[model samples]
Target: MALRTVLSDPMLRMLALAVLLAVIIPVGSQTRPAADLLVSAGVFVLFLLNGMRIARSEIRLGLRNWRFLLPLLLWVFGAMALAGMALSSLGQGLIPPLIAVGFLYLGSLPSTVQSATSYSALAGGNLGLSVISAALVNIAGIFVTVPVFFLLGGTGSEAQIGWESAERILLILLLPFVIGQIVQGWTRDFIARHGRHIIWIDRLVIALAVYVAFSGAVEQGIWQRVDASAWTWLGGMVAVFLLFGHLGSWVVAGALRLPRPDRISFLFAGTQKSTAVGVPLAAILFPPEIAGFLVVPLMLYHLTQLVVAAPVAGALRRAG
Candidate 1:
């Protein structure tokens, strides 16, 4: 039972898969063509499944909660952007430029849906609020991210959203998601019965994306450029960033005088970054060489948030 619990833990599973892929895929014989195709297909399917899982009622509920939703959005997109810009500017020499860019990009992302909602429920939070808030933020992020990136000076002429990239995003991510939602009425039963399997699919896609990203980085001699001390510093910075983000959210929640459940929802939803969306967007927005570096902060933040938030959620649950 304990072993199963450990294996089933999303953070543990993600960490194991990422570490394994980072080590193996670089040395393996997976060609670039194959990796690209696999990563693209995986991202498409992942988003499709996500769309199918979210019900229309949830969307309606999310839209109605303007009082809570407005503040959450401001914190996620506005305050976080300021925090990221501050970090990048202040740590100019301390951290690698690309890694700092990674931090900025991470800040531009949306809150996580599955893990955030799950943790909120476990922490005895308002589960509906978590679900609706997470869903709404991600949907908004799809359109908002490009402008946010440009505003942060993270994009250049080459990185600008060309017709091809926009087409790819529409066809690969949005189209299938629309199809999924359209068919949800007919497929609702099957989705409910087998919805849990989607978790494995999500994990597999993330691992594959990590593997492909790292493989490209390895080919670009990422190791020679980023040494051990750099990695150590990057890891420390990521930890600090996540801790600060969580505590800041807590403070904001308190100042607003939010109820306990809403506060718990705010903490998890506000602090957690979406790896599922961030990885795919990075792959599309940046070249392979830099995409790997850009995603490193995201991966680190994802893991760190989970580790820190899990215990806090448990404590909240116990106290409740």
Candidate 2:
């Protein structure tokens, strides 16, 4: 009956956002830069607010577990770098670099606190390890990503360094996390007291972000070049990449004689890519057309990985 009730249910909320995005199709044809900037800023707020719920202690512990953390970090960066090179070999030029950067960002990002912890728990991983790993990646991304962008030649060249695109991303993402950590020291009890209320707000923010992002893309006329066939290839490639990434992580884990819990952590967290982080970064770094094509694969992959990984994770749990 209530607006929050209507928007806080995950399935219904996501569907509602998707429909909102669909309707934005017509509105997008005429929206101006001011409107687009406003929408982007809204999404950026969600990014910051999401970090506020996480405590600083969780982050500190996530960093201290360097054995598991270090290897996973290497795997993420290595896989992304290789993916870039491999795609280039297949004759995909600008799109490959964009995608590689997406994958790299994927690698460098902190694990989804809820999703990673849920999967790790379901698949029998070390819970503390999962928490720490997620925190470490996110914290590291704040520092690592800036240097990475420069090292990968994302400086004053094309994306326009003077515009402070990289700085904006860091400010939106990293600044919030650090602030939350500082606040957590004093407000831990208060935060925990209102945790249930916070959950609904969190969902609302995510739903709004999804709506804004899709709408902004529509506003930019990104869908013009996206055809049915293009979507199909994107879907197909995502499926292939998901299978390969999962298997690759599994093989590496087993070869290293990792424990069962560690292996499961490696497989799911390592293989599942984040479109939330990837889409915004792509939008910033690439021309509209190039970003559109590059984003197609990630969106498909994001959808398919959840569908496919759920069953696979369940099967693994049953076997164990």
Candidate 3:
């Protein structure tokens, strides 16, 4: 994973463009209902493809490697979950309350399957373990992140999750994924034949998620609320989260005495966060305005991981 490779990523660029559009031309309230419907449909398609692409066999095989997978899960959701709680608690009066919540959500997310696996491979990792571990973590995330979030003080007037939100999560995110898994045996060839199309469609939905989420922030005057000082504070906190993630993953993997290749897989698997899961889940869990605000740290951390992982991968490769 070269720095330029991450920098040249069109998806990252599209994310920026989505934010720009959100700032400049947010969806109006008159169109909110329609936009909401469209975004929901996109999310359904996004997860459906995710299920189709990731094979059930991989998960079953990876589950047998508890020695490796268990530690990765605990480090990602447990240690990092506590880290986010501390950071969010410490953020009181220093940043906007909701911006701090971003830290909690960011910390609890699953490692990104694509970038983490790619970086692991670049660093001479166990690519098989990297792929399956990432997939398993993400699969766990759809169920884990929200409940952990709520239990960790994510519940209140601003961030409440009611029955309606739960139903939305099931219908929009879970049901489609189940359908994809059931039909994947039939659709495998079609998905493989149209891999390029699937990739673009995935990216478009993610971009639209960013657009829809950020538009609410724009409508709430995110720019006005997040000033120079707040931006500085936010930047500092994001850096802390990044440092904690990468360094913690490396140390924990070493302490576990994993072989070098397995250690490398754990390294990337523990550090990265998935906006694809985090954003849509946020939209369902919180109001669009609050979801937009909550995801700020997550979006920042997601890009930073791309930049940070390149060098880490290079270092690991050289070390290997």
Which candidate's lDDT is highest? 3
Question: How does residue 141 of candidate 1 score in lDDT?
Answer: 79
Q: Please identify model 2 stretches exceeding 4 Å from their true place.
A: 1-16, 19-51, 88-110, 145-163, 200-209, 219-221, 279-294
- What are the candidates' C-alpha RMSDs? 2.8, 5.3, 1.2
lDDT of 3 by residue, 1-320 (tens): 45687679888888999999998899889998888888888889999998898888998999999999999989998899889888888887888888887788788888888898999999999999999999999988888887877788877437787788889888988898899889999999999999988889888888887888899989998989888988888888988988998899999999999999999999999998887788877866666788888999988887888888888898889988
TM-score of each: 0.90, 0.76, 0.97
- The 10 consecutive residues of candidate 2 with the worst lDDT sum are 87-96
Q: How should the candidates be ordered by lDDT, best one leading?
A: 3, 1, 2
CA lDDT, candidate 1, residue 127: 92
Cα error of candidate 3 at position 265, Å = 0.4
Ten-residue region with minimum lDDT total, candidate 3: 153-162
- In candidate 1 the C-alpha lDDT for residue 267 amounts to 88
How many steric clashes between backbone atoms does each model show? 0, 1, 0
- Residue 78 displacement (Å), model 1: 1.6
Ranked by lDDT, the better of candidates 1 and 3 is 3
> Whole-model lDDT for model 2 versus the true structure?
0.56
**Regions more than 4 Å wrong, model 3:** 1-3
